[model samples]
Target chain A: MIGTAQKIAIEKTKTSKITSVDFDNLPFGSVFSDHMLVCDYRNGAWEAPKIMPYQPISLDPSAKIFHYGQSVFEGMKAYRDKDHNIWLFRPEDNYKRLNVSSKRMAMPELPKEYFMEGLKTLLQLDRDWIPQSEGSSLYVRPFIFASGRGFHASPADEYKFIIATAPSGAYFSSGKVKVLIEETYSRAANGGVGFAKAGGNYAGQFYPTQLAVEKGYQQVIWTDDNAHEYIEEAGAMNIFVRIKDTLVTGPVSDRILDGITRKSILEIAREEGIPAEVRKLKVNEVVEAAKNGTLKEMFGAGTAAVVSPIAAFGYRGSDYDLPQLEKSYASRFKKRITDIQYNRSEDSFGWRFKV
Target chain B: MIGTAQKIAIEKTKTSKITSVDFDNLPFGSVFSDHMLVCDYRNGAWEAPKIMPYQPISLDPSAKIFHYGQSVFEGMKAYRDKDHNIWLFRPEDNYKRLNVSSKRMAMPELPKEYFMEGLKTLLQLDRDWIPQSEGSSLYVRPFIFASGRGFHASPADEYKFIIATAPSGAYFSSGKVKVLIEETYSRAANGGVGFAKAGGNYAGQFYPTQLAVEKGYQQVIWTDDNAHEYIEEAGAMNIFVRIKDTLVTGPVSDRILDGITRKSILEIAREEGIPAEVRKLKVNEVVEAAKNGTLKEMFGAGTAAVVSPIAAFGYRGSDYDLPQLEKSYASRFKKRITDIQYNRSEDSFGWRFKV
Candidate 1:
């Protein structure tokens, strides 16, 4: 907030804690950014907002975010168009969802102006960091944490909102992905923070996902909280079911997330004369249909992948491969979403915002 | 782990960020000990185990814990007895549960030995920081986070486990407290992280809990996720209902925390020949029982409060107060639990572990 456009002062502190990480040709999330945006909340207002060269933040070791896990975040990208203009796809959605996530986590709700302005500041200063390769973008991570120094079970009075960017390539280096229908583990619960993009929800998926990974799958498709009989979502992304000509997804509730990409895809489906259903997709029905070949395609929708086609879904010790389509919605939707995101197409939906 | 039983210099770094402070009159979670236990996971094993003076942990702003909520935590206390002895009650249970939570969040499993060994190292060095107040103890918080420093919808390849302690006094200066029944917002869903001690679980309750605080209530009694019709646990504690000669409470599942104190109380109730039933507790039943004079008493049980008697419950926009009894279970059971905790009574259940 101190910088009208993001400005940062570099600081270097050597830490011999871990081995030196390789910084060249990094995979997604395997590299680093040298600077980050930070702002503090104290005396009931945000103060001393600034970006500093990425360095370790000294904490009491009893900070609530570490122990209580009182943290939430947003995932977006800063795209470098051919003309070198930085573009954010539906950034207002991320800013709005971040506040919703903060309220659910009992952390401070960031001002919309502050969040938007903060992104503008960080993106402008870190323009060199945004990679230019196809499927490449500067992954923008804006997060808020309960930084109150303590080991107690309560809302944090003081907080720090920080923004960091990482240059991430495609979500999957592979062309297709295989996932598991999560019959046992769940990402979130009904009446919980499922609707809010809170960090704990993703952490909950790690263990079950590791199991899925061992079983040779890429992701777990979570079911409903009550019975696990209803299909819900795939990890942090919202899911879509393609049955013949109709596209279906779970309704937003206390269980599923209201993803920014999910919403945009629905609008695109409407624009293309495709019928989209936002309702519960029961597991039994889908499984039975998969056996009979009505399940034409399955894919996940989120800001990260845009659209990731499911190669297969493992369920009840059985594996099933989805039917292939020549003009598949997965590829179509992905291209449509990305075209608007990267400014390769007209912004008919007005989703893209200039940074 | 490298240290002998004799006191030695582990690691030293006084925080200059905090200039001055009174450690004695500290608010719960408002202060921290100097040294903290830290362990890292690298190359498929936990390595670099050390107890160092508390300091800032540098992270890429795009760390996965911030965006996707990949974090979980555990809360337990190290108590000091009259002999200046330190003890951990059900620490193994906490460590095991922490792994259960970590696995659910896609984090690495922290070794039980590391958990025990880490606490021993940190507490031994920071023993002077543990207060000696009547209801005071060194509150220990152990947590694991996704240390993979960037954003994508996948598990972290690296992790950091830490333990920090805080000196605290009584939660409520007055022994008694009041609670409200939240008939709208639920704490967790049937197949959610309610059972796990995940950080996101605590964050989800902040909004509704804040509403309760604004209305002059201490906490919200969360109901079942689906209907919000049946009573469940407190946001951070478990609820116990005493109606007539029968004691009824919600059954444990994926949706509710298997509270340590709640189980201990059930064991005590069984020992005392009291009829204790762990089943779905409906709000209407409690209201009707209170109307029929069958509702003897109600209270919450957890490590934080031990046993907190509910003076009144606001449900369905109506408040109900119960008549106080001479032999409230809160007093007797709290005494029974704390007596064993402070080494003043028999450890019949073998719950306490001496360090």
Candidate 2:
């Protein structure tokens, strides 16, 4: 582990591609920033970090990451305020979660100082890539993978951790999206790695989500693997339900991710004197609420999208449409969080870290 | 897709390292052959295959395989007979399963010609790597992964298929091993990717398996995710149970892999006039059989170990020890499959494909 006293070596790119990027029509994660932070773990410790030009990484064909899926990742964003100041929202949470994910994947844990210093150094060098437009930010992706040259099923002796940033617009082009209730497929099960930000959890959802897309839905609401009766999460996001005057969501468990955005929303709701409950929300109960006109709003919360409203949801053989509220919980929280992230609002919880 | 008429380009290593390997202490998948096969899928089709020295592959930092776990792999072996000839048992079956895994992971399917030619070319160039000793062979690992540069949570447009070989002795050194019936964790569930040879399926089992290992068990007999009532597979191999005079195993489902060795064992059992049944094997039924002193033996079947007999099984709170037999089914089948694999016996089913 590299302490805060150690400096990260910098390697600037010879040419800049900022002008070549179409900022107005930026795709979610297709365009990258200039520099990236890289660190390797070997000989029982993490080496010094370095910031270099974003490029391809070479790995052995028998790397355990490509064979056993021993990989974990975290998604975050760097915001640019109107006054040209940059901010990171609860970055410590991401670093802590990253170690948790590494433990579950049987990989070495990354030190807090190494993770923080690496991100800070990389972000400062590529500060210009932070988009100034509202609802747009520089998406930060930090990932680790096994790099050892063997096909053994056990953990790899060597690993590489990388931090790459991409200029992005809103994760969802359309404000409101349709979701299909996944009845046949499961994203994870009890005693599984669903709680960790592991790569396999996301990869397992593509086929089922693709099926939902063919049915005109943008995402699938994943259920518990055993019964498929309780709602766990939506595609890459923790879901929330607004029933009359209360905010309800499934409680965090080993099988459900502990999303930073989800935590912030629940904290904000309670601080604002709103009624909120965290418990198991059965699929039947939600469908019944939708039918009885008690389900006021539904949305997904994650780093990529602060809050994406669900326009409608499909269950077994039927599509239930949700009414657009005059003032929804999703809309209220999205504005409050984005404002806090951009430094336009007061920071009461000390969630903002300036860079 | 490349056709059969297209020839694979070969590039051999200038120097060989066969003498450096110790045949007496060969690890399962540690030592590699001199050459490997590579094929790329881009622009909606597979390109011509190439055989080159086994080495590292360069990929972008944001490749989907690293972030989303869009990877699949297969495990088979090449046996060297006493006559100094190599044989691949059911190689076509492995190729077909690789495509099935690719489709499930949303990766591009490799052409049959590309898959077959790549393996053959690489095997011939490094034929000496196949050890001639009994229970020693060259383990073939064919895998495919997403190579496109992006962080989007979707299927990649680019993929690479690779076939690498490693010299190996028996996958399991112990003749009979202890197994723990997994009760808490689920290997896979209905509508999950358990049936596919995807990388995540293996990764998810590591932590749980490690816990079982600490309890003095070498492997685990995974139960279904829902009720934990029905048996699935054991470790990476399909499981078989012998009760009284009948051999029974679970039928393949969306939650179980269709193992080639498992299929061949069933066929051989019928041909040898042994009673066999392929259907749902409930956990309670096996426990009941053990209590009544009717359960004779249990074993795992796969390409690596061929047939590994189980000495005991622990379920709930009690461990049931199996009695040794003078002429066990496991011993008979192990010899039969190894004989068939090494071309020491008649090619009754035309299962051997000579290299």
Give the candidate number with the greatest DockQ: 2
The residue-by-residue lDDT of candidate 2 on B147-168, one tens digit each, is 8878778888888989999999
Interface RMSD list for the candidates? 2.2, 1.3
Tell how far residue A351 is off in model 2, in angstroms.
Answer: 1.7
The lDDT for every candidate, in the order shown, is 0.77, 0.88
Which regions of candidate 1 are displaced past 4 Å? A1-26, B1-9, B12-26
Per-residue lDDT of A176-255 in model 1, one digit per residue for the tens? 78999987766666667777777777777767888888999988899876688888888668889898789999888776
Model 2, total clashes: 0
- For residues A1-355, write the lDDT of model 2, one tens digit per residue: 5666248888899998899998888889989999999999888888988889999898878889899888999999999998888899999999999999888887889988888888888888899999989888999999998887677666788999999999999888887799999999888777677898988887789888888999999999998877888999985899999888889999988789999999999999989988999999999989999999999989999999789999999999799999998888999999889989999999898899888
CAPRI class assigned to model 2: medium
